[model samples]
Target: MNKITTNAFHPMQLKISQADIGYKEILISGADAQLQSGEVCLLIGNNGVGKTTLIRSVLHQIAILRGTITLGDKNIQELSVKEIAEYIAVVLSKSAIPQNYTVNDLVSLGKYIHYPFYFELSKEDQKEVRETIENLGLQQYDATPLKNLSDGNLQKAFIGRALTQNSPVIILDEPTTHLDEKNKIIILKTLRKLAREHHKLILFSSHDWRLAKEFADKIWYIKDRTLHAGMVEDVLIRHHELTDPSLFNVNEYFKAPHIIAPPLYKEMLYSLLQKNSTADLSHLSFEFMDNRWHIDAKGNGYQCGSFEEILVLVKTLH
Candidate 1:
């Protein structure tokens, strides 16, 4: 086993080339990407599309069938588990929570890599743990039991533990699992801050691409047994389904109504109007004014109090 320095604070890059990742059979092939420190990358794919397999391969928990994964100057396979731990800190979504452990206790475990659990933490390590908790906005809940905390706070506590690890690279598998929109925003914002301000390389897997892409610098998209790595916008624009799955189901026969409303209401009206077909496909305009929908069908105007009423009117028009 080779020993590597644990505290070198230089810019690090993770590179993958022509890799095949999976267990018995290859799940994802031709995987290639380069991710640098100070960047937040999002790993996106449908369920069971080897997102986790690729992450595990990078962590060297599973061996790549072919090609190479290099972190900085060293190949991942050549690094020992402990050495890899020094480089990467991970938070798995389904990792078991210690039943009776306090938030402070769980977060302090991150320092065990540097200081053994049996020994008292040096003052510097203690301060680091405290700062990590405070940075996570978990200072008030530091002494609270893990079971007592909400899922959002518990997820942040787990992230606090990762922050305390002080590794250059941080990987999270579904960090926003089961979190509401507010918590999801909070978690992603925290990751963006860590990557931009702290210069930590962050790779996180998520199904929430609509929201997650806004915070990501790069995207590692697993599709059709290939890994596509590029700027988030570039990748999303190249793959239309990532932006809107409904594009696949566009009805050639359906005539869309001219909807004038807020973007949100306009999109909703377009979606709802798609399901109904009018016999007279003449000019139809639906305008939202004063919180009500004003409809004009071939110069005949009707006011709709609600979406249901609008649909009922559509039926009458048909």
Candidate 2:
């Protein structure tokens, strides 16, 4: 069993060493990693690379098969569930929380870790909960039931709960899973703010590499039965494909119709990490407006129902 030292003082680092990522059979082992205060870490890997296992181990929901996991100076296995709750808060996909709980009520559960059973909220705690809800843009839904909010809004409420917990470390599994581009930015920006302003260590797993590259202090890449960690630049250097992006063609810079283009669509098109379409260089201009695909080819306009359509149309002009 893991033990929590009574030291209880905050350390500058959360460290893991020689930890086994899975049970029954070890999925990955001898994994060593650390995250510091004021840092947002992105954990990324293939579907079965044990990223979730690593996170669950760190959160103490599951024991590591071997080695040590520590938050600050104390080993994580030693910490009791309550003590661990104070150190880390988590947001997971597919939660089964009660439908009747209001958004505020859901967020307030984060404070439960700090209080005794049947605990009443202090004025300070109330203020913190309210502030976190507002910060997540959940004020309009504060009094609304969780069942009533859209999936996006509900996701924000869960995140706000994690924020309200006031833990030094926060872990999230696919925090942006169902979000649109705007809400994805909102969630990640909030994480960076928490890391920089509040000095919280944010560990999150995401498939959104572009946003992670923009905001994460470190990228933790788990792959091929190994764990790799470094600042975004260094790690990205190792993974060259992420930087060598081609969202569209390389031959020309066709003007995107401005009305439906996402913010900085041109930059995004040029900086895309991959391309699924090959556009003809002549008589065809791609328009990325309104988060959808459209094309003006030889002065003929067409709106694509999907990206595949755009790809098909682009090839038509080829």
Candidate 3:
């Protein structure tokens, strides 16, 4: 029996070192991840970081070079593809819809998993399909041909299809790739609600750090050929250890008068503030240290090197 770690939360889902990818050597060696019920996990890394590969590996659509994945105490390898479908639903980067398929037809296909060989739709399935369409605000497009719909509408239809599957876990790969800002927020907010209100596990990969930090309960950061997993704040702050100074430029740009550090550095500064618990960061302005590349807080044109210093200044106030 595999001894579960104390840190392991009740797994809504799990992906162990399974790699079914074509590469002879593992693209991601010894990768292990777990998602708790009702939690949203965000997978983030630069392009070609094996996010899709890992997803496929977990689903057993591809064979693992080594290792095992378990979902809710059941080994993934032991489950048939159809059995896995009952627990895990996926929305891929691209969902191909037949040219003649209507939004309602596409969403209705999700029920095929539960149907017998004849695949007759029951009243319950039809009700679920309809509810999914309305929940995603896709009622207006229900009769529209998928090929004729806009990218945003089409994406929502894809999500509606996944919801109709009624699985406990939904995995998406770069879901916001082609979406505009408004649609992106809508999709993300919808996923967050699904996790919180419906008690589903929602895992998605994205390049949007700001949105991920704001919405995700946990973050999986892949860098320098390794995976680090933790709360979003912890992973972001620990990113400094993996920074490649030569490959990327690091600079502080002023958003208003306050210096806005890059995501990684900003998280680091926030971690420092949290450690000291002194300075009320809600009021301080941020500036960058030109020489050391550290972010510092400033107020009334006075620089505070650390959170403790900021606290002393705050004490002097009033």
lDDT at 117 for candidate 3? 41
Residue pairs with colliding backbones in model 1 are none
Against the reference, the lDDT scores of all candidates come to 0.85, 0.78, 0.72
Candidate achieving the largest lDDT: 1
Ranking of all candidate structures by their TM-score, best first: 1, 2, 3
Residues 169-200 of candidate 3: C-alpha lDDT, one tens digit per residue: 89988888878888788788889999898888
Candidate 1 has what TM-score? 0.82
Looking at model 3, the pairs that clash are: none
RMSD of 3: 10.0
* Candidate 2 per-residue lDDT over residues 186-222, each given as its tens digit: 8999999998988888999986667666889898888
Worst 10 residues of 3 by lDDT: 249-258
Best by TM-score: 1
Q: How high a TM-score does candidate 2 get?
A: 0.75
Total clashing pairs for each candidate: 0, 10, 0
**Pairs clashing in candidate 2?**
2-77, 2-78, 3-77, 3-78, 4-78, 4-79, 245-273, 260-289, 260-290, 261-289
Question: Model 1: which ten-residue window has the lowest total lDDT?
Answer: 1-10
lDDT of 1: 0.85
